[model samples]
Target: MDLLALETPCLILDRGKLEKNISNMHKRMKTLGVNLRPHGKTAKNIDVLKMALEDQAGGITVSTLKEAEYYFSHNIIDIVYAVGIAPVKLDRVVALIKKGARIALILDSVEQVKFVAAKGQEYDVEIPVFIELDCDGHRSGVTLDDSLLLDIGNLLHNEEGVILNGVLTHAGESYNCKSVGEIRDMAETERAMAVKCSELLRKNGLPCPIVSVGSTPTANFAEDLTGVTEVRAGVFVFNDLVMAGLGVCDESDLALSVLTSIIGHQKRKRWVITDAGWMALSRDRGTASQKVDQGAGLVCNVEGQPLNDLIVSSTNQEHGIISNRMEKDIDWDSFEIGSMVRILPNHACATGAMYDRYYITDGSTDIIDIWYRINGW
Candidate 1:
């Protein structure tokens, strides 16, 4: 069955484009001599995870325990919970570790060190943990100069059941970069900080072994990996409007799109309503800060190409309004009911969560497989 055969308001992943994206990123990272640990938060489908691990050593980065459990049950051994795991989730972490999954958690505070150490001693399980260093003060990470990384590293090293693996960081500020050249510089600086912190730990005799750095923008533009050992990138697997705006990838490289059918139109309002709304495309206005703000999503024709003078201006709970980006009037009669269209999402992660399963289209653009996704904690 083709795309038209699938139920309306469904998500679809083009097999050819997905493979091309994976191949392109793998080739790029291999050229830099760094390990690729693709983030699993983009496409949580087991099929996509298998495709991501097919060429490499199969190490992955997951944002939550459920994702870790999902991949681990499918034989993904070396996994890293990239998020700062809380104490409430230690039971799930211990369970995954007991099942033979070599998982590591992220920590940026001495409080976390004490928490993990106390929990490890209580559960009698050796939990490997990584200290997150703030490379650019973009998000959750400790400053390299704060001595917190070493403090936490030494604390864990001296603890009874806790093992300090290494350092990890995400250059989230790279997303706000002006150009790919800026992104490359950001990558270099981010890697340097992570490496420098790791060296500091080693100088203190903490035996910092694993040094990790990850960000989609930096990963795509990085040409230097002198001290970086591994790179974690999730959005690279499914390029979105944000990636496109940064010139990281072209519009064609986007693998996932929401399929929506025109349901109604209002001539006076100069808008066409579709079955897809915030529920189908998500409400993540990722392009709000970009040069061109994509309000909800970019309107595309049924063939998956951008529509001329068309944009999803606004979206409700279950309805989407489509109109020209400018204030010019539109011929609502041209858009007949039952016309199917695709909406390129703003954030691939948020949009992917809006659907339960993906209508896997093969090389022929026919619905071949339906890959289910597991949600919740």
Candidate 2:
């Protein structure tokens, strides 16, 4: 099917760009001498995961138990539930473990360690876990110098059912960096913090086997991964406007976009409206703080080429208003009522969650294949 023939407000994935992105990240990890455990939260599709895991270690980092279950059902079992585990979810985790899934959980607090250990004991399954560390204080994790770090590590190491697999940290602040140099620094800090925590644990007679750290910005710009065992990144698979704005990737490297049609127009206001509103484009204004604030998304022609300085300036529940960012006159005649256009998302992960499937293309209008997404918790 041709792209134009597909329904509006649908996801379009360029196979060519997708392949290039996966290859580039894998090559980057190979050069850095670290394993790449691509995060499954972005695409949420097994086909994309398979492409990412090719010629690399066979492990995945997922944000939810549903993702772990889905990927495990497909036989991709070496998993890490990167989010802090809720006590109520222990049963589901144990169910997967009982079925032979070598999945690991991450937690920061001593209370969480006790809960996890107790649950593991209840199930009589040896559960693996990583002590989350706060590298740059971007989000969750125990600080490297926190006294609780040793306590949690010792508890997991000595606990009967739970085992301390390693330490994990994310340079989420790398996304806030204004330059590549800053991202590189953030990467080093992330790696150093994880490695230091591991050393602290090992020095105290505890085993810290894995040291994981990553964020797309850090993974792409990291100078070295000397002591880091694995890197986890997701948005790199479909570079978004936010990533492009951060200088992590060029706009042309983006593989995912929302296909929308010009539904109406306001000639005097030079506004071209589209069917893709926040419902389709996503409410993630991730690029708003960047040097270049792409309103909702950078507007492009149906062929995926940017149309001057066009952008989706504002959106309602079902209406997207496209206008020139520089206040230039829009060529109303060119964007006719039925003409189709594409909108690059600000955050690929959020925009991707708005859809159930991806319309695959080879950087053209010709649709070659269709891939399903695993959405929900």
User: Which candidate achieves the best TM-score against the true structure?
Assistant: 2
Error of 2 at 215 (Å): 0.6
Candidate 2 lDDT tens digits, 1-377? 89999989999999999999999999999999999999999999999999998753499999999999999988987999999999999999999999999999999998999999999999899999999999998889999779999999989988888999999999999989999888888988998999999999999999988999999999999988999999999999999999999998999999999999899999889899999999999899999999999999999999999887999999999999999999899888889999999999999999999999999999879999999999998
- Error in Å for residue 322 of model 2: 0.1
Reference-based TM-score of each model: 0.97, 0.99
Per-residue lDDT for 285-369 in model 1, tens only?
9888998787798888766878766888999999999988885687666578997888989999999998789887764557888
Give the range of the ten consecutive residues with the poorest summed lDDT in model 1. 49-58
RMSD of 1: 1.4
What local distance difference test score does each model get? 0.87, 0.94
Residue 85 alpha-carbon offset, candidate 1, angstroms = 1.8
Once superposed on the true structure, which residue ranges of model 1 sit more than 4 Å away at CA?
Answer: 55-57, 331-334, 363-365
- Alpha carbon lDDT at 183, candidate 2: 89
